[model samples]
Target: MNKKVLLVPLAAMTLSLVGCGEPDVDYTDNTRLTMRVHVDEGSEEGNGYKEIITAFNRENNGKIRVDLEFVARSGGIYETQLDNDKRKNTLPDLFTFDAPKCAYYAKNGYLYDLSSSFSTTEQDNFVALNRYQSKLFGIPIQESSAGFYYNKDMFNRAGIDVSGITVDNPWTFSQFKEACAKLKALPGLKGAVDMRLDATADETATYLLYPFIYSCGGSFVDSTGLHALNYFNSANSKKGFQFLKDLLDNGYTGTNYGAQDFFTHQVGMYLSSGWTIPELDNHVKWGQYFPDRNSWGLLPYPKADDGTAVSCNGSWSYAIGNNPRTDKSNVVTLLKYITNAKSSKVITQHTGMIPANKEAQVGYANPGSAEDVLLQQLNKTSVQRPETVGYAQFSSAFGRAIKYLKDYGVDKSVDDAAQYLEKELSRLK
Candidate 1:
C-alpha cells in the first residue's frame, strides 16, 4: 500500500455527512445514548462493526447512536488518551482493548461487569482462552493468533517442505532455527527470517517476546508480583531469551524487517497476526517469477524441547463505561445487538479475524472459502496472551531484554539482566 495514502489514520478524517444525519426527532425520545467506540483506522472503511451498528439502529429505530473514534496505531497516543480520559472521568461508553491492557482496565474497575448480561451459552461461543473472569469485564469481539508466515516460493527454492504442518504441528524451536539457517545458506536467497529486534517497531514486544515467555512456562507477571525483567533473568526465562538471541546471533534475523515489511518484500518468514494474511496476499506481486501464488503459509510458534506448542491470541472486546443512563435497558439492548451472531459473521467475513461467537465461525468455515482452511488450522491451536494488570510493564521489560540479547549475544551473562527483570516484576505487586 502507498504509505502516503494508507498511512492516514482513520481518525484524521471526519465521517462523511452525506446520507448520514442526526436521528429524527421522535426516534431520539425513545432513549438517547451516545457511545464512543474505539476502532482501528484500517478497519474503519469496511469494518464489520458498521453492519452491527446499522442493524442495531434499524432494530431500535435510532434510540441509540454509536460514535466511533478511530485511534492511531501509536501505543503512546492510545495510552495517553485512555489515561487522560480516566483522569477526567470522561471515558467512552464502549471501547476495544486487547490482552494485558484489558486486564489492567478490568483490575482498575474501569469497565462494567458483563458476566450476568451474557449467558453461559453465549460465553461458550468464544474459545476457552478468550474468555476471562473478574466481574466479566469485556465481551470478546474478534480473536487473533500470531505465527510465522513463510514465502512458499522462497521455501521451495531452498528445497524446504511447506506442507501439512500447521499451527498445531509447527516446527520445534530447534527445527525452526535450522530452517532459518538453511534458508540463509541458500545461494541468492533472501535472509532466513525477520524477527523484530528494532526499537521502532510497535509489535516488537507484543508479538515477538510473549511467545518465548509462554513457551518457557514463564509468566509476564507472577502471582507474587514478578515482571518480565524478573522472568528474563530466571533460569527458565534464560532459555527463552537464549532462543531469541541465538536466532539473531545465527544470522536468521536482523533490524531490517518488522512485522509489516517481512511479507511485503517476501523476505524470510515473518511472525504476525492471522489477519495479516489477507492483506499480504493482496499486496504481493505474482507471476512466473513468483511461482507460489499461495506464496504464504502459516504455522504456530515453534514448540519447546518438551513439545509444548504456544502462540499468543489478541482479542479486542466491548466494554461499557460508568456513564449513568436514564434508560439502562436501552444500553443493554444495544450491547446485545452489537455482539449478536449476525454482526459477528460480518466481522469475520470482512476482516478475516476469527469471530468471538461460535455461530459466526461457521460462516468463515463454509465450503470453498479460504477462511475455512485458516479457521480449521487455528481452532486446533492458539491461546490468549496472559491477562494481567501489569502486562504493559511486562511487555516493555521483555522488549528491552530481547534487544539486549540480540545486541549482546546469548553468551552474555544473565546476572545483570535477571536482576533488572526481577526488580521490574516486583513493581506489579
Candidate 2:
C-alpha cells in the first residue's frame, strides 16, 4: 500500500498562481483537504480510489488527511454536482473530471494551472494529460482504448477466423460489414453487432464512436481547437459516418439492443472498451451464462477505406480546483500519490483500464494478452477527442446527431448526419 518514490520530486513544487481575491477557505490550513470523485461509494472504481486515499492517509498519518466525496455518475449526477458546486463556490480542493471537459473547465476557471505540479519530463510519462491553452490542468488517471468484442463461439459457428486480426492489422470497413453479415445469418442471434447506440445520452457516444469519424481521416475540430467546419463535414468525415449509417440500413445493428445484450448472448459482437472484460467476468461468475475465458476476443477498430486504424483514448483525470487559497502543496501531494505509477496500477487493476503512467504500463500486461492488445492500440492508434472549450457542446451535439441517425435512417433523409453534426458545431462560437 506504500506509494512509489515518484512523489519526492513533485512534492517540492508550488502553485504559481496568485489568489484571485479574498480566499474562501483558511489559507493557513493545508493539512485537511477535501477531494471529490465521480463514482458510487461501493463500486469497484470507487473502492480503488478509496484504497489509494487510505494508503495516502496512512502514509501521511497526522501530517495530512483527505476527505473523500463520492459523486455518482449515473444520470449525469456527478457532473451536475460539480456544476452546482461551481455555482455555489463550494468546489473541493481537488476533484476528478473527464479528460474531454479539461478545456471547458480550464476556460471557465474551474481547475488550477497544474503545469507546476508536473514537470515537462514528468508530464511526458503519462499517455494523455489534460492541457488547455498550453498549460497542464489535469493528470490522467488511466489511458483508454476501444475495440470490438466478438463472441468467439459465434465466430467459430460462422466459420470465421479472427486470429490474424490485431491492433496493427484490423479489418477494413467492408470486411467488418461482411463479418456482421456472416454473424447475422447464424441462427439464434439478436443481431450481428451491438454498437452501443443506447448509450447516446451522455459522453459515451462521443468518446466511443468518434473513432468512426477519425478512422476515415475526419475530425471534430481543427488544430486550433476552435473550429469544426470542413474538418467535421468533409467528404472523409461523411464517409466515416456513412459507414455507421450503412450498419443500421443493412440491419447489422439497431437501436433496440440493450446495453448488456452482448453479455446476455444476444449479439455476436459488441463495440466497447477494456471495461467490458470485467463485466463479462462478473456475469460469468454470477452464473448469468456459461462462457469461459476464451469465449470472446477483443478486436481493434476497423480500418477506414484509406487503411487507417483509429481508436478512442482518454479518461478521467485528477485536477486541483481553482481556489488559489487552498494549500496547493498538500493537495498536490495527494494528487501525485493518487496518479503515480503504483496508484495507476492499483486503479487499473480494479477498473480494467490501462495505466496512464508509462512506468505502470511496464510489466503490467503479458505478451499477447488482452491488456497488451489494448495497450498497443493506446500506444499506436488511439487518439484523444478534440480539445476545445466547446467540447461539452460538441459531445452533446455529436451524441444527438448519432441518435438522429438511429431514429431516422438514410432512407429517411437523415443519412447526412455529418452535415447535421457540422451545423450543430457551427453554433458553438
Candidate 3:
C-alpha cells in the first residue's frame, strides 16, 4: 500500500522536493498538490469539479496526487475565509474564485500568471475575459449570466403576456415595472425578489444588480475608474434606481427569500443564474409553473432607455495561489488538462454551465435549454465585472449602499447612496 501522506495545504513545490526525487516513504509519488474548490455542494458545478478531480487523479496516479478541499458557495464567508488563508499562507496550491476578483487578487500579489505562458493562438482557445490588465491571472472554467426567472402561473393569473420577456424582445424598464405591479395585484402572492439585496450576497450587487444600471443607459464609474460620484448619482442612473425603489417601495418585491419564493409563486420573478434550475427530468412529473417546460422562460435584462441591451457576466474560475511554494510544472499541467476542449466538454455536461473554452462552447450540453438561454444572454448582452484593483471595496460599499435603499425605501435616494459610496471608495483608494 502507498505510505500515509501528510498534506501541506498549499505547498506544492516545497512538499514535492521533500526527498531526493520523491517522498521519503516507499510510496514513490513524484508530486503532490493541494486544490481548493468553491462552488455550492450538490451544485451542478460542484459535481462536475469533483468528477474532473477524480479522473485527473486516476490518470496521474503515482505521478502526482491531489488533496482536494471543497468549500460552499457563500460569497461573504468564503471570500473572508480565503482572505484569512492568504494572510496565514495556508491556501491550497490552487483555488477557484470569480473572475471579477482577478484584479483585486492580482494587484495584491496573490496569483500566478497564466496568460504569459500561453501562445498567442493557444490563448485564443480560452474565454477572452480571463485576463486581468493584460496578464492572464486565471482561466474561466465556466460562465453564467444575469437574467430573470418568472412564474408562468403568476403571469397567467395576472393576465400578463409573458411573450415580451424573451431574448429577442426583452422587457423594457417601464414594462418590467408594470409587470411587477400586476404581479403584486395577485392574491396570496407577495412580489418579486431582487436577490442582490440579500445580506449574504456580497459580490452580487456588482454582478447581478449592476445590469439594472447598465440596462438603463446609466454609468456606474467613469473611464478613469476613479469616480462614481457623477456617474452613479447622475440622472440616468436615478432612472434605474428609482425603478428598483418602486419595486420595493410599492410592494412589488418581497424583502426575504424563502422556500415559498418564486417556484411556489410567492414572488413572481427571481433574478439569478440558470444554476437555480432544478433537474428537468422531474419537471414533467410535478411543479407549479413551467411544468410543460415551454410554460416558463428566461429573459434578457431589461433594456436601457435607448434600447441598449446589457447584462452581467463571469463565473468562478481557477487561479494559482501566490504562496511561495508552488509546483509550477505540475500546476500548469493540471490547469491545462482542466481547461482544454475535452475537459471543458466533460465539465459543462456536469455543471450545465456554458463552456469557457471556445471549442467546448460549441459542444456544451443541452442546447436550447434554460442553461442555453443563459449562455445566449451572455453572448448577446453581457458585460464583464470591472477588472479594477478597487473592485472588492467597490462591491462591498455598493452592496451596503443598495441594501440601505432596499431596507429603508424610496426615501433612501440613489443620489444619497452615491455620495455615501464615493466616500467609502476614497478610503479604499
Candidate 4:
C-alpha cells in the first residue's frame, strides 16, 4: 500500500519559493521539490483528483511531494477565491480552472505558457487544451459534451422511432418539435422535455445551450474575435432562439419542473451531459422508474432545417501559475502525470466524464452504447465555447436573453438580447 499524504491549507503556502529556479528549468530534472495543487472541494471529480495525486506522490516518494488543497467550487466562490489569490500574488504552483477562463487568466499573466511542455504529437492526444494567443495555458482534466437523454419506454409508447437518429443524421428542428408534440400527449409526463432552465444562473447554461445557436448557423463573435452585433443578432441566430420560444409557446416544455423529472419519468427527454450517468446508474430511486439502463437512449442535438448536427464541448482543466519561485519542470511533470491516459481513465470511470486523453477513451468503444453515443458526438460534432477574455460577459448576455425569450416572447427578446451582447462587447473594448 502507498503511504498517505497530509492535506495542506492554501493559506499556509501563500509565499511560494521565489527565485529558486528563476525562469524555465530542465524538464527532466530530478530535483527534490515540494508542490501544492488546489482544486474545488466537495465533488466526485475532486475525489478522483485526490486519488491521482496520492498515487503520484507514492510513485515519486521523496523526490517530489505534492499536497492537495481544496477551495469552494460553487456559486462563483471558486472564481472569487482565485481572484483574491491573484491580487495577493499567492496563487498555488498549479491549479484547476474552467476551460473558458483560459484567455482571461493567460491575458492577465496569471498562467504560464505550457506550449513547450508537450510535443505536437503528444499534445494532439488531448481532445481540447486551453490556449490563448497561440500559447497553451492549461491542459484539460477531462472533456465534455451534451445531448438529449430520452426515455426509450416513453418514445416507444408515443410511437416515435429514434433508431435511425445519430450524430451524422440527427433530427431536424421540425422533426424534433413533432416528436415533442407526440411525447407530451402521453400519460403521466408533465412535458416532452426538460431543458433544465434552472441552470441559467451558472456556466451550465452556456455549456449546454450554445449548441442551439451553432445548429442554426449563429455565432457569438466574428472571425476577428471582437464583435457580436450582426453575428449574435443575425437572422440565423433569431431562428434558433425562436425555435426554443416556440417550444415554450406550444407547451412542449416549461420553466417549472423538478431537476430529476426526466429520471423519474415525468418528462420524455432531458438535455444534459455525461455527468448525469452516475446519477442515473446509481441513484437510490433507480429501480422505481428505470428497470435498467436500456430504458433510456441518448440523442444528438437537433439541427436547423438547413444545418448539420452540433453539440457543446469543454470542461475544467489543470494549469500552472506564473510563480517564478516554483520549479516549472516539477509542476509540468505533475500536470502531465495526472492527465495521462491511465489517470484520465480512472477519473472518467469515477465521474462519467469523457477522458481528455484519446487513448483513455477506449473504454467507451462499445458501439451504440449510451456512453458510446456521447463519445461519438464529442469526437465528431461538438464545438468549444468562444475562447475570448470576454467570454464570461458574453455568457451572461446570452443567458439573460434566454430568460427574456421566455418572459417577453421571441422577436423583442432576440433583438433585446443581441443589443445586450453588443453592449457587453463594447464594454470589453
For each predicted model, how many residue pairs clash, with residues at least 3 apart or on different chains?
Answer: 6, 0, 1, 2
- C-alpha-based local distance difference test score of model 1: 0.62
342-424 in candidate 1: lDDT tens per residue?
Answer: 88777767767888666777656554234544565456655556555666655665555666675576435444555655675
* Winning model by lDDT: 2
Per-prediction TM-score to the true structure, in the order listed: 0.79, 0.85, 0.77, 0.87
Cα TM-score of candidate 2: 0.85
Model 4 spans > 4 angstroms off: 1-43
For candidate 1, the per-residue lDDT at 138 reads 70
Q: Specify the poorest-scoring 10-residue window by lDDT in model 2.
A: 14-23
Q: Candidate 4: lDDT over CA atoms?
A: 0.80
The residue pairs in collision within model 1 are 226-425, 227-425, 229-421, 230-421, 230-422, 233-418
* lDDT string, candidate 4, 195-308, tens digits: 876677777767888888888988877754557778777888888888888898888988887897998889999999887776677747687787678888889899888986
Which runs in model 1 stand beyond 4 Å of their true positions? 1-30, 40-47, 62-81, 128-133, 199-201, 224-232, 258-266, 283-292, 326-328, 365-378, 410-429
lDDT of 2 by residue, 1-429 (tens): 447566654554433233334346554588888899999899999999999999999999999988899988888888887887787677788999989889989988899999987778888888778889889999999888878888888899998888888887888998999999999999888889999776777777778888988888877777666666666666677677789988988889988898778877888998888877777777445244535667778888888868489888998999998764555888888888898899999998888789999999999888787778899889888888888887866777677667877566522322344455456556665
Better of 3 and 4 by lDDT: 4
Cα-based RMSD of candidate 4: 7.4
lDDT of each: 0.62, 0.81, 0.70, 0.80
Q: Which ten-residue region of model 4 has the weakest summed lDDT?
A: 1-10
Per-residue alpha-carbon lDDT of candidate 3 for residues 174-280, written as tens digits (9 for 90 to 100): 78778787877888876655454664355655677777776666776665455778877677776766677777777776457674366656687778776666542
lDDT of candidate 3 vs native?
A: 0.70
